[model samples]
Target: MANPSHDRDPGLVLGFERTVGDEVQAVARSAGLVVDVVLWMLRRGGWSVGIGCGAVDEPMPASPREAAGPAFVLAREAVEAAKSRQRMVPLAVRGSDEGAALDAEAVLMLVAATGARRSAAGWEAVDAVEEAGGTRQEDVAARLGISQQAVSQRLRTALYDETRAATRAATHLLTTAHP
Candidate 1:
């Protein structure tokens, strides 16, 4: 949804349901999609995101306009929390008896660091490294027809290593999470 106050800024709202004792591997898989979407949105300069996971009291309406439920409430709360913290994304997950809220601070920092249009080339350089299946920097440089030193500079400029580490941590938490 586009922010009402600022037409240029957009917000994303996501919700899902989970059962007790349900493994979060699927959630982890979905996080990859989230990561991609966040990256794409951030590149375009609007990355306000909110995610909610819980059971809804009301049935889903044919149109989203009529949708109202606990999940929606949680999502709104998450968005508010993000706004309060000046963070890009916030996630709230509710299980049968447990709930968790996370600020996604690390990923937001990574996004903020690379949000400028000037960083697009560095993002492409990072993508090249990732697409090569974590190949050596020299290999990435060769493939991109750039000097290794140039590739290194781009990687550093993009905070590639720190971003990768943060992503890994997110995946780990999601995969091992109880809720």
Candidate 2:
């Protein structure tokens, strides 16, 4: 909505609100969903995912339309910045703490780019293992009708461990960015 003040939603969807600049704005109660949203958006492809973290107006309302703060402003900036990037991963982070925000963005972009390079076969192995729980490479291999060695090879090629580690680091950075 170009004028968010005039528009109101009956209910929030996925902890975000449809707002101006084509933003699904996440506010206080919905804040915890940011990392999950980013991870899911990256896997789905074709989205410029931006995260903003910082102080919100005291006693924030349930609706994003009713909320106004630096966090919302930063989110707009982050998404606009993400959209402007040409050949890079469509992801960004912005926060009251600039350094932590940059660190978060760096880690997230590295992990996203690395995952982007993963092959379809590699994703299959990754999916299977994830579905079966991280402990069972054999289960993943059997489900995918590939050898355990092949499953391991695919994960190695995909750098799954590195991605997970980077994701954790990014999440941590995001948390530190605001509070």
Candidate 3:
């Protein structure tokens, strides 16, 4: 099988390896999964995987001013790839200090938000809000006289709930369509 890393950009390749290395180490220590072999399997399975900076990298900067150029580049790439439907995982290597951990969390949250938006449920809520003339979360909240946080929370919840419902509906439609 072709290596998923073969055609990927050099920076992305490094990021992937870095992320996978960290996850593998953690999984081995805590979950009993071998880091190397799992990565090998994933690579063979055609997944475009990239690793986030693990905790083992340089200390997290006190502010964005302190972050390394490469670190920011990798984070931006990972976030963009995730937004575009490419699978990106941030790997936090073992021994990463607390600061790095915080940075990793922020990156992962960006990935999750992207994933949520890509979901069918997410699109439905987005569509609904747009149809209702709400151009953005803040706009929606303003119209409803609620906090932006509340609007965000409601959008997320509605997306999840609607996605589940849509999935069921699709399944039923498929079943009946074929029957």
| Steric clashes per prediction | 0, 0, 9
Cα error, candidate 1, residue 59 (Å): 8.6
Q: Write the per-residue lDDT of candidate 3 for residues 7-44, one digit (tens) a residue.
A: 23332222222333232111111111122232344423
Candidate 1 residue-wise lDDT, 80-156, digit = tens: 55446644433233222232234343444454454453377787788788778879999999999999999999989
Q: Which candidate model has the greater TM-score, 1 or 3?
A: 1
lDDT of each: 0.50, 0.74, 0.38
What residue pairs are clashing in model 3?
A: 15-51, 16-50, 16-51, 19-51, 52-91, 54-92, 54-93, 55-93, 55-96
User: What lDDT would candidate 2 get against the real structure?
Assistant: 0.74
TM-score of each: 0.57, 0.84, 0.23
Q: Which of the numbered candidates is closest to the native, going by highest TM-score?
A: 2
Off by over 4 Å in 2: 1-14, 28-32
Output the worst ten-in-a-row residue range by lDDT, candidate 2: 1-10
Model 1 poorest 10 in a row by lDDT: 1-10
Cα shift from native, residue 147, model 1 (Å): 1.4
